[model samples]
Target: MEVKIRNRSRVMQVLALAMFLSLVWAYAQLEWGVPHTVKRNVLQSRGSILASDGSVLARSVGGQRVYPQGVLAGQVVGMMGETDGLEGLEAAYNRSLQAGENLKLTIDPKTQAAAEAALAQGVKEHHGEYGSVVIIETLTGRVLAAASYPPFDPNNWRNYSAETRRNRPFLDTYEPGSTIKGLIVAAALNEGLTTPTTTYSTPMERYVGGRWGSTIHDAVPHPPTLTTKEILRYSSNVGMSHVVENFAADKERAYLSNYGFGQDVQIPVVATATGRLQRPSEWTDLVRVTSAFGQGMSSTTLQLAAAYNTLANDGLYVSPRLVEGTPAGERREVIRPESARTIRGLLQAVIAEGISNAAGLKGYALAGKTGTSQVAVNGKYSDSLFDSVFAGFFPADAPRVTIAVTVHGATTNYHGSMLAAPIYKKIAASVISNWAAAPQQLPKP
Candidate 1:
């Protein structure tokens, strides 16, 4: 009887062991198998990103994300990671993209190509560390092109550095130098403080910020006296100081803020810099003078383009848009239409009569301003390094497109008029040709 009872107990122990083994196998399968299947299914179902013309910018195939137009608007389209987007628009709208929804962009492929080509040539020719070009449609604020040089190839993004992958138009910020002069001048016009023909005694150098403060100098030799129109044409730093000399600091900050400086531009891209604009309380005489000429302040290339677009759009500030189906950007009257028109006319004169004549197209009425700001190294401005910039709009009488260009750390030919202006011309010419833009009669200088 005792032997039979011991045998029954052994049988019971074996059955328990078998049950434990089966449970372990089921748990292992649950841990490894189901998630793998779901991941595979998710990747296979990932959606595509399309340009405005339905050309595929990014799409998933064979469980991999592919960029058809390699290095073409790559930074703007961005790249996907092992399981998600890593940067740019991909990252901006990752959730919808992962859910198998298509993201359509406002980027025009031909315009993007033209901008990239022009920017590449200019940056290479000038030996710049990097550069970016942003083209915004005047009326809609749709970004036609946003090109960054040393282009990032989404297909091979791992090979490039973060700097190369950076969308400089949105992410990078620099003191815009004299480009801000146009905005300041527009404010002066709005306030009835000055007119296009108003005159200021613009010496080559002046102590507008008081003798103990920094002395401002004009980039090029100009007359001791210059009209407000000529001040813009010459891009005279000293003249900018004089224009804003009587302009109060709080009011200046208000105008800049109204124009989108120091304010979030609310672009879809990640980490778009608002670009530093100090409080009015921080404004000293020297700071005010420097800010007038685009020092003591900084702005992204997109912000600069959009500000010029406000002038192009007849005083209406349209927030720049990248993704389609997104709500249209905030539109507000930043300045009086008359004041905006006056600014455009003055900028047109700059292209026609100033050093920016290189940007002029034979038949198209172009308007723009050039900026060359010394780069700050450590804590002080570096004499050797500079940021060359150009901001302009085409068919100035009735503008359709606004463009902003920047070449950073150029080794030679660093002036905005020398490098950025010509680049602007090349891009504008290509765009005009691509669109077969009608020729407008150039206004008399």
Candidate 2:
């Protein structure tokens, strides 16, 4: 009986030891001893994204990715899936990020915050369906701020609509309306086809091509005749039609193409759209004329901002750079420096005495253009909805920054000067204060 009890106790002791060893082994596998594949499945560590000032935008916390400031750059920084990037800058630099490379963005936190605040306010006040703001360093082509409205938090991305997830400045395109007039005028001046003082018979409306073609009209009534500079100031579609009436279709396309249309503008972000511009072969007289004042074609806000930055950079077109390693694109002189200067002066006049006069800043020169384009829905244009836009460079005498603001789907009378220019002014003022970018004196002639 004693031997039997001792044997039973020994067996119980061995079973208990075996169970303890199994638990220990399972813990080891779960903690650190598992296969690499299994480990990868369980462990997720992503690199961090920092602003120019070293503030964290997105980072890994407790093995899970988190955006510290919630929606600081929700759409711009993009979101990540369990294993990899899904959109935005995260997707653009996915490989590097997955390899644990930390990224420092060109975005200025203060500038970005200011842009977002102003954009949100403008969109709400104007009852816009959506809005976007893009700011770029004129000389270096660095993207300082890219703000998209209908604020989203990546942490709860599923709750946000796809429209909010989209990076509007990079993906959305629209007929630029009169904002395009600046480029058209620049092209005309660059080609020596006309000067700022060149005069045209400025009717309110003019028919184009045959009856099949649409008639172009100015947004507001204008004088019977006006100079090129005055046409730009007033944002006259009819006057712009006259300015580009003699321009060949191929030349017009070439100029617009050189200004960064009809191509994907590469930044350090995955989402990009090559805005739709019809081929030269498809250009009818109406199409060509309408395109002169920003219709019958499309361009993203970023593309437009970069194109305008060309003028701010003395006619040098430099593609935007968002990542630290990527260099500013090669400089291509799209227009004569003199032509750019002339256009800048004309744009300044737009704020000084034109419809955008309210956009003027005290003690500082401002230059910009406003656009309000009708939106097309289901292959037909909608009369009730419009996209209002503004594009400009600040401290007009010495350009340091270029900005573009667009408010989409305005139900009310959508005038760029009314809906978009104020937003631009608000953001620009903040940017100027944030960077202390005030100019000392005008550059020498």
Candidate 3:
């Protein structure tokens, strides 16, 4: 009878211990969330990233993340690491994605393909080290295409360098050169400082910061005087200097800020650059003159596109969006509607008569500006290296698409007109031909 009693006690103790262990496990779960093993299992079934048309850009298969679209939009869609995201949208929306929540993008596959093809071809043909192209819907500021090259294949991401994997449109910043001329001219019009017909003495080369200051030159040879429209057409740095001479340095900086310079472009990317813009207090005479003609400041390709979209959107600064259903960003007026329209007309003249004439399509009314800025090496600007850029909008009468293209370190044919403009033209043509509505007739010069 004593032996039987001892056995019963031992059984009771075993049951009590099991219950105690169960309670402790429950408490741990409630306090610290799911354990790592279970969490990893959940991550193995990570959600897909889809385009607006419901095509999968990224998905997990057999415990490995796969990019279905291959190199197309690879930088924007991004790839995964061993257990988490490594770059682009993957890194930006990691937690939600790991929870099996799908992320939809505003990207259009056709537009993205066009942009990638043209950018890759241009960069290769021009012998550029790298390049980026961005296309934003004019009214909504939705990013339709953001392409970078040399192309990255997330399926084989390990093969590419970090520079190749970088989203250059949002990350790389460079001096935008003459492309900023359009915005500067737009600001002058907005502030009632000048009209398109306003004339300035535009010598080919002239000392900008008084007689002792550095000299600025015009790339194209033109007559002694140029109207504001002609200044943009010829890309005359001297003429731009005169236009902004009386414009206060502080006001100029304000205008740049209004145009989205030196501001964080809050997109759902891992890391984005707020391009360098010096304070008004830092603007010396030389800085002001150079900044007027698109130097002494830096901007990303995406930022440049958004700035041009301001004019395209009738002076409204619709923040560029990448993800579908994301809250719209700042929507404010940067210029008067009339001023925006006037600037549009001026840019149209640029395609018709300016150095950017090569960017024009046969049947489409396009407005754009070309930029070729010297890349600064160490402390000084390099004579051999250049960043070629083009920014434009189509259907000039009522713009629908805005595009910005930049090619870095092109070894040959480095001019924006020769290299970047052709790339823009090809992408614009493809976009117009494939998905865009029939473009109206080209506007007369």
Candidate 4:
């Protein structure tokens, strides 16, 4: 009787164990969003972010990769879509920003903060339509801060249109305007077109063909017999027009290629445009002259940065980078060392003594160029709207970081000096003064 009872208990126990195992197996194989499969919800996921100094910029609230900076993060930090197509830095380095990996961006948050603060003020002052500011680490090609106005909050990316959410700094292209003149000066000198001492006489306009005409005038007009230094300072179209008309097209083309025009950025982000750099063979005389003054061509802001960065680096164009892993970009040799030096001085005048002279920082030596291109409308330059830009680097002797500041529409004035240069001054002052490295002496021109 006892043995029978024990056997019955053992049989019941075995049955219970079997049932439990079946239940566990069933739960393990439970379908998630699909029949008969187990799945986890993405709404339950999170991400992380850290600054260079080990500070948390943003992290998931529930301990995952999430938008912590809200809408303030620029195209470089990226966006989290409702359906999960990562935009900006989040998309570019999804694995790093989310997978609990440590990332050290080349940006200095302090500098970025200053830039943002200044730009915020600028937008308010100008009542501008759109704007962006980028500060770069010259040595590493790391984008410290890249932002455009009317920021689309990354948190509510779905609320904004794709166009507004798109990263304009690295994505959009425009006629770079007079900003390219600084670089043209550099290339001309490097290719042995003329020295800083070289000069040109100006006319109001020069005609290449009947309809294709190039004009030389300042924001208003200035001296006619302008030296290369003076041409850059005053931004003479005639002088630069002469440059394009006189220099070998192949050499100029090579310089522009080296300068980072007509090239796509390597930031691991999608939809980056390779700005148009029409070859010498394709050029008309008008195009050449206009291009000399940064018209008749288009370029992404990153491409513009690359051009200015080259001049800052003494004619060595290093690739502007934002991602980790293998760096496919390189330093292309564009100009002779002295030519680079001479142009650097003339550009220095832009910030130090030229048109943008008011953009200077008290103790630091800086050189840069201003661009105020007319916005295109119906395939013609718009009379009212303009893209104002200021591209430069500080401590002009040995530039460590280069920056590009732009405002699409300035209510007070359309020129870059009145708006862009002021912002550069504000950002540069804070960035250079706060750097940890001992303050270096200003480089001699």
Candidate 5:
């Protein structure tokens, strides 16, 4: 009887062990499925993003999406999810990618790297809170590089904030400061209202629309009288006010809209910010005067680059291209070729002798404008905060590429010339080195 009882006890113990192992196996299966649920939803193989030269920017390997270039063009290329893309070109071309179609972007890998390095250095050296750089092929409107500073590694995107992941060139809008002066001047030139040599009796400070205490000031102390070219070179607000005197508010709005302001630009990516501009009906004298000098209006770096591209393309505004095989959009003659050339020359003078002299490259004609605008805080302009910008193209006589750089929240070297111009110079030189086989000699203006 004792032996039978012991045998029964042993059998019971073995059964209990088997039951526990079965439960353990079930728990393991459920836990494993939980983690793979996100990935299991994907039904197809994802595609990849490549540079114009076939360098991989982002790709899938062993069922894991990876950015081989790491942080290079992170915001521009964006990141992928288990099932689809999240931002930038990834999100824009999600459907095509999911269908196993390869995407070749217009982004030049070398130029993108150069832009990233230059911007990163600038942000660190200048102690800037943030910065952005954009370069576009003048004729093709192909985006060579769209780099935002303090770049985040898409490989570890969760570690970064939305601001760090933001595609600034396409999304972030700020008062373009003096950068818009060139466009305003271009508008004036296109209207035949003023010549580059046309002179204005510019004052250091003047009341807007003759409204007392509503004053606009120039950054540099200018002469009592200056020419239209001089106004651009000096980036004089008061001079711009006088230059736009012939322009009606409605006419200015038309010109602005024609230049692709206040409209979302559809690239291969989902970049949509037309930037904010007051309607024609909302334009008061103060608004008009401030808008003339790049205040009272806001634009993205991409918009600024496109506007500069107009000058580069000899007055034709081309939509920016991201994917290589994408069709070129309709090219509209917004400004006369002659007017665009004149403005280009005026901008060259800005680099050659004006506030943007720091941006000039040796043996190449650099044409760009510098903008320094006060940051608006809580609907009022801040006293100490500022955003600085430089926008221009290289080889002014025969343009190849257009570049725009903006540095935000600059506390100390806040002027565009002081902070942004150097960055522009670095990026321009790097891009020229990569794009041009033999650098063309530009004549001294």
Candidate 6:
């Protein structure tokens, strides 16, 4: 009987040892291929994404899909870590992307390459705090090239500095400066409160009721009487407020809504931000005038690009989408078709004769805006420091791509035209050069 009990005990001991071994193996299964960076439940095999030339842009080689595009696609291809910031396309399309199945992205590799090169050059020349470039397909919402300075290399992701590695295009919000005035222009025209021909009497600055007067001024003043188009071209803060204030708060709010403010875009990465647009009920007079000119307002770079895409699509405002697979190719119209024409015409004039002239592409007609705003330091707008931004599209008559750039903590004048425009032009030129054939005439705004 004792001998029989000993045998049973030995069998139980073996079972316990087997269970412990299984638990250890299960824990190992959660680790990534990289020994040091053990992410939880990280798939050993993600999938394949091929470039236009059939070369692999990314794949599930050593477990997780490796981003060959490197820093160029960083923000869009965000890292899945313990902390969340610019969790770009990779995190966004993770489940849908798996081994065996391939994700055919719409991004043109040639364009992406160009964007990276141009941004690098710009950074080298300016050597600002940091910079970012985003190239988007106007017809489809595919993000072609999203590059940032002090870029993050996915190979050694943990080594990248947190601020330098962040995908600034979609994650960070800044004062959009005079760039947001485009929406005010659209709102005024849409509400029938003003027309392209509407006239505004300009003073360099005007008064608001608060301790901070509502008075608005120009980045550089020129004329006293100007048309709506001229006001936009000049990016006149007072002029923008003149038209915006003429309408009720409801009217202005409607325009911003149509422009996609207070909304997040659907992109691959989960790292996205919806810029804070004070609800009409929450707006004050002090906020109103500046908001018209993109001050007292905040926006992510992607949100700004989406708005410009409307003009690129001839007033068709499709919700921005980013994913891989066979999804619907249809677009929903957000603005009247003809309204697009009026805005594009004015925007074009700005590129031709306004402050953002440096952003003009060589062979293509480009339409875009430039903005420079004081980033709040010590609770006040500091002249010494500014955020520079350039947002626009190529072939103004019909745009295929939209490129937006932001330079943070620039030491130069930091105007959008002078700083950011050149980067967009370089990227556009590079993309156009590599196309197999001339693109079809894009839909005009």
TM-score of each: 0.92, 0.88, 0.90, 0.84, 0.90, 0.82
Go through the candidates in order and give each one's C-alpha lDDT. Answer: 0.89, 0.85, 0.89, 0.71, 0.85, 0.70
Q: Write the per-residue lDDT of candidate 3 for residues 198-234, one digit (tens) a residue.
A: 9998889988787558977788889899999999988
Q: Please, what are the lDDT tens digits per residue for candidate 2 over residues 1-445? A: 9999999999999999999999998888777655555535432556788998899988877666788878888998888876677778777888888778889989888888998999898888878899998999999999998899988888877888888999888889888888889998999999888898999998898887676787777767779999998898888888988899889888988889989989778664456889988987898888888889888899999999999999998999999988777765656889989999999999988887775445876657789999988899999989788999999997776699999999998776468998899888888788777767655543321
lDDT of 3: 0.89
The alpha-carbon RMSD values of the candidates against the true structure, listed in the order shown, are: 2.8, 4.7, 4.6, 5.8, 4.3, 4.9
Between candidates 5 and 6, the TM-score winner: 5
How much is the lDDT of residue 126 in candidate 3?
85
Best by TM-score: 1
Clash pairs, candidate 1, are none
Q: Spell out the clash pairs found in candidate 6.
A: 76-89, 78-88, 88-269, 89-268, 89-269, 206-215, 208-214, 341-445
Q: State in Å the error of residue 77, model 1.
A: 1.5
Deviation from truth (RMSD, Å), model 4: 5.8
Model 6 alpha-carbon drift over 4 Å, by segment: 1-44, 51-54, 62-66, 79-87, 96-100, 209-212, 326-332, 355-357, 435-445
Q: Alpha-carbon error at 260 in model 5, in Å?
A: 1.2
Alpha-carbon deviation at 24 in model 5, angstroms: 14
**What lDDT score goes with residue 258 in model 5?**
76
Q: Candidate 1 regions off by >4 Å?
A: 1-37
lDDT by residue (297-338, candidate 5, tens digit) is 888999889988998899999998888888776678889999
Q: Which lDDT value does model 4 have at 299?
A: 85
Looking at model 5, residue 341 earns an lDDT score of 89
- Of candidate 4, the 10-residue stretch with the lowest lDDT total is 32-41
